[model samples]
Target: MALRGTNQEFGRPYNRRIVLESIRLHGPIARGDIARRVGLTVQTVSTIVRELEEHGYVLSVREEPRGRGLPPATLRINPEGGYAVGIHITPLGIDAALTNLSGDVIESAHREAPNATPDLAFDLIGAMVNDLTGLRPGGRVLGIGMALPGPFGVESMSFVGPTTMTGWKDVSLRERLAASTGLPAFFETDMAAAAMGERLYGLGTGYSEYYYLYFGVGLGGVMVHDGSALRGAWGNAGEIGHIPVVPGGEACPCGNRGCLERYLSLEARGRWSGSDADWVAEIGPVFRNAIAVVENLFDPETVILGGLASTDLLERLAGSATQLPNSVSARRDRASPRIIVGRGGQYAVLRGAAALAVSGVLSPRFGQMFTAERERGRDLLQGKGMAA
Candidate 1:
């Protein structure tokens, strides 16, 4: 399979990642099955599997058959192989959690940040990691994944554009976290991470194309196509928040008039309601407009309402959307895409981050061993090394 990044001199890491992803996606599969699935030979698969088993990332189960020459062995992911730490930083506070391979939260710590700031935020994250790692030493935390309120660059681990987050522009969050915790770090914008979480374990299950609208202090968007995020040029593909909806309504932080976020975000609703059923009545129109935009543009398989928004609010908005007249010309018997509420809600982003981090560690591509093995394999094929 084609690798996504620059070719590494050591290729074992890539192979490891491939093998791990195969097992994670299709476990209880035999070594021969894994080889066929990953496009690797049986010998290569066995080598990688043995190394994975030795490293505690894979476990084997013996299968007894009614009539068989020998019992076949099935391979599965070791849920306890390693742990991933995920954090979601919102305006109100920071939510930190640790999850295993199965995406089960083993420990969680919430820190209230009455006065949110970059310095305080980083400190809170460090403290949370320390707390969770201490609580589950046996889990061997591999790294940290942060879901922040901003736009993350697709090619890099930095914020892409202006964000509602204070003092977050051009911040090297990954480096800061690695320095603070002495562990590898990965980062994603809150919306994209939430979308990932939903795709893997929430309302997005079985849907290849969908949109996850993150309604928080600010509105954000995440688009998934073919089971992967569709990050546009400069990683700004999903900045639907800045999409002009009202034309000349309200001034937005992105220097636009009447951006979609100004009309539909939680903060906007709070202002509209003046604390009168603030969560529900205020966001109703915004949700309607958002649904209309999604339908006109992507017509996705489903549009998931998530982020910090409440499910009750989502249900109300979904009901309201259905009442709107279809704008499509000569509409036929095609079913309208369902507007569903997400399971993780506010915690979705953090959980998605945890999932990415865990996937990175448990699989071989994220580890050093996999890269080395691939490099050696290439060298041997090139006749640079003598065959045994």
Candidate 2:
């Protein structure tokens, strides 16, 4: 009946995960720092560190001198601990990559997803994982993170929204992948993954609160607050595509009139412009209008324009947004939030999935299991018997 299940059974694993996550996020971090950051006592942090070091999931580096006191030893994640596979399932193809703890892509493979069905997609993904895992540096893969078109529910394995692909709705994607590949799997909306990618490795870094405006086949926004993606009640937060931008412009599939996606999305532009360049020119104003709406409502630190929208297009849109009327007249002196292009481009979603997978492995909730596994492996190598 418990949401997270029994604490007695999950406590150690949870703590270990937290410790590993702390190290991954702020590595070359001292034990004291990990303790402070993870909200655990020094003794608990020391215990976790010992476990990680024994397992080879983490390694202690040479002490760095700070003052007259003894130099503090730093800890870092071991890239060899495990590997994660990230797959971006776009309308065109399945772009996949294998990455380690450091987010370095070791290998990549792509296959067209043209008219892809759930069975065919899962089979291809399984084969891709097999091929990539065969070439892994240590021949061991931890898990897989899949990036799919929006409205994904891992519990139900249902995908809602406008997807050209079939057999996707209500498909237990994670279960199928796990069964086919024999590894744990995680699923995330492509836009949400892209947002995570930006936070970890792209422009969204440093800012704790921001919005990633994904403008691809459709338009959506990913909201981040205090370094975590804000999934509102029912996990439907940041559904900006449905936000009303035009009262009678165009009808949307979501049973709405003149939705933001109808104006700002590439699919909408395709009806207006025959090519990508033409779409960029025509959609800039619409994109600017959407930005103005977001700025006026959320007033985020920055609005990251991404999806398939080009950098030049985003810049022009940013310039145009400055001309829109502001309702908050009292805050006229406040500088408007900057609108910038996402750095990952077409691969942003996949990159974000990989990053998310890596984070899961290094997260404090799962760190202990990894640490225990690593320590067991290390003990075997050292000819020291591990605890049963």
Query: What's the lDDT for candidate 2?
Result: 0.71
TM-score of each: 0.84, 0.83
Candidate 2 vs. true structure, TM-score = 0.83
lDDT of each: 0.71, 0.71
Q: In terms of lDDT, which candidate is strongest?
A: 1
lDDT of 1 by residue, 211-306 (tens): 888877678788788878776776656778778878778877666688877767777766673653555565567667667677677767777888
How does residue 360 of candidate 2 score in lDDT?
A: 58
Candidate 2 C-alpha lDDT tens digits along 1-388: 1112113543555666677777887788998887767667788789767877887778888766668887878999888777788888866668888877776778889997775778888899999988988886454476788987765543322343443233577778778877878876777878888888778777777688788888766777888888778877766577788777777878776666887877776667656736556665666666666766777777777788877666776666666666555543226454545666767676677778877766655554444445666566432112133232
Off by over 4 Å in 2: 1-11, 39-44, 63-70, 153-166, 274-278, 319-322, 327-337, 365-388
